[model samples]
Target: MKKNYVVMDGNTAAAYSAYAFTEVAAIYPITPSSPMAEKVDEWSAKGKKNLFGSTVDVIQMQSEAGAAGTCHGSLQAGALTTTFTSSQGLMLMIPAMYAMGGQFLPSVMHIASRVVTSNHHSIFGDHTDFMTCRMTGYAMLMSSCPQEAMDLAAVAHLSAISGRYAFMHCFDGFRTSHEMQRIEALDYEDLRGLVDQEALQAFRRQSLNPEHPTNRGNNVNPDIYFQCKEGANVKANSLPDTVQHYMDEINKLTGRDYKLFNYYGAPDAEEVIVVMCSASETVKETVDYLNAQGRKVGMVQIHLYRPFSVSHFAAAIPATCKRIAVLDRNKETGSVGEPVYLDVVTALNQAGRGDIRVVGGRYGLSSKDTTPGQIVAVYDNLEKDEPKNNFTIGINDDVTFTSLDYKEIELPHPGQISCKLWGLGGDGTVGANKNAISTIGFVGGKYAQAYFSYDTMKSGGLTQSHLRFGDEPIRSTYLVSSADFVACHAPTYVSKYDLTEDLKEGGTFLLNCPWT
Candidate 1:
């Protein structure tokens, strides 16, 4: 465990983790999530062997639903199956999810959750697509970054076999999915321990076989249907505990504590913020800052968002907490609050801590920036006599006036050397940075992270790559606001975007143009 750093995006990390557990992969390409499926396909083509000592059978399907159906069929036939998808693609998998849930098939689906298409057809990051799958009976586990995406992805697949339930191990679409980072990878051999040999054998026995001659997918009458369905409650109810058991096993291997809910802050924190995914990492920096200044602020990160354990969530909060702000990534426009916020309200009521005030706020809709400053505003509001209950950040909503006014804040740039590269889509900027970070992170024993953003015009769009290198873990979840260096990877970009926008006062600007 000294160093097994892999410089890759969350999508690649998740895909790599799933590759170790999967026997068959039903694949289809969609933005943000496509790289995950593509990686599986490439590995299988290269004759990569899984834990079962065989190359995974990766089949490209016609659509997301077709992929889901193929996974369902494969799982029913005793093949450990998985798939990667997002946004509309995820919606297409819903019908199959219902069936997979009923049979309690151990299938794992890796998702880079995206904004559900409303009036806008944006290909940005959000939890809207995932929020829709709450009732799908899949064990929903979220990864806060590329590292967690890999770590928790293993947890998802292991839980698939342990709990006999489908999994949607999700990360922010295009945010974590495409963001590359330095992370210690889970050795497949170490991961092999989380695999329950007994469970796998039992799962195989349950598979449909002509030799055994068992009936499945039979239509039961209303008289007997309810009783038959209720029978599954035993396993369904035990799933959360089953998931935590695997988490405990992983903790032993990785030495990183993961739980249903994780808390970070002063032990006696009073102002609490509840949230998950990439923003939770950003909030932790803010929490660290506030705590350093002798302020009592904390954050409770929800990892196992499904099963909605009221007791577990409430236990993570400090007893001194009086005001709680639930920051949700996706919005519920017509509803009283965002999904996590409302869920927190319900959980508090169920935990019988109604005296503790909990409010929900929305941030990072369509990958909108969630900075340390905006989070500071939430903590600032928590101390007020009356905090703005339903709020939005990273925007000035002067018309409706739901936004909070906070100082422009950038993360405390430690020893990290940050850089930005502006390029056209056709340029090799992203690929170059990927290699650069890997070389630096893997060779220099330094931690590095990279993130890319581009327009919808696939090949000809504007592209920006953000790169950071440091001796410590990279915790700035947001993009490079003030880089120490800026480079224009394409000359055309020089006339388009502000390539030197946030370069430090004495920062270097290198234009990758012939004339320069």
Candidate 2:
């Protein structure tokens, strides 16, 4: 007895989770993830059938490197392939993502992430095309909205068909792919019983067979080609414990708690921030309004970014965290930093915590606007004892500078909730706030979050949706400093800006004006 549904964004929950277990997708389109390959080509031109019923071969390529060479020849012809893109079409699928991770090929790409134009051209949202596909070995994850982008795109297509490896499953393009909400529609018999049906039938009984003839794309002529590329890097580092045992069996059938990096504020917090996509729901509402004013602050977010756990991010940074920032929406010009602040300073110097200081910044990127008073000015410059070393957030650097001053703070309201939208640039108000965050995460069961701010020249661009519906699991991050409800679909931006500063004192403002 479970029938709840509602979707409208995060590109229709990534084309309804790639029309569930897609047999072959391979699409190509850009901008805020080209309406998820135009809703999987209008649900494969209205045929729509999955849950093992089949009928999903939506092809249509000719770009994003010919949809990553038709998802590497439809996963070497055995099928179960997928695709969708963003930002320079995920940088033109980096050499077919290093030949689908040197032939481990288990495919999954979805990625609404945008903003990879550099110094100018932008389509919004950012992470520089999934941080330039972390060395192209694939396995990146990130998602902060649209029911964790349809339960992590069904846990990266059931852990890429039982851990063969190749996934990207991102989010945050036009704020969770055109915002819309109301969820609880994933249980195609519990995602076809979380894959591994005898290891996807022994990977289709070891494919590429013409009555069992082998030999695939080989050319290793360097005497055991570096021992077959270090045995394909020990099978891509044992696929992060086979993707954490299918993310602990889908967190024991959806009790919600996916790991590979997922901690949020206050559990013995001191001052943490590290981030990932969808602006970690505005830094979890500023870590529930600075832990309701007591202020210890905490946050981690980051979901499996190319197997970079480092002991699960140094055991979710606690040992009385002594100030860290990391942020990064992508910008790595002269290197030494950028990939999530050099993997949180190499996982806090390999956990020795080297007196934990860490600092690295650059924010919102092509999509700009990172508010909550610029995350309370990066937690007031980590309560400065001598802060500045490397920073920039939201902008205004006094004519050619490092940026850091946007201060005018006055935020603290844990039970805070806000919503604001001023449509125009393709007015769907980010697809009706991703359908109100899947109807407040399925009829207000709560723990729903959304944050969006656009307008860096994308034609009449000016959008904002920063929502929060509580009952635990919120953890404030940034933007919507105090809202509580504010919607204004362009009544000329309530006479140009200051749309009631940070509301709260009595909150609730919804304006789509017409009373001319």
lDDT of 1 by residue, 23-131 (tens): 9999889888999988988988898889889998989989999999999999989999999999999999999998997788998999898998998898999999989
User: Mind giving the per-residue lDDT tens digits that candidate 2 earns over 351-400?
Assistant: 78979888888888766667677887888888899876468888877776
Predicted model with the maximum lDDT: 1
Model 1: lDDT of residue 379? 95
For candidate 2, give the lDDT: 0.76
RMSD per candidate (Å) reads 1.5, 19.2
Pick out the ten consecutive residues of candidate 2 with the lowest summed lDDT: 471-480
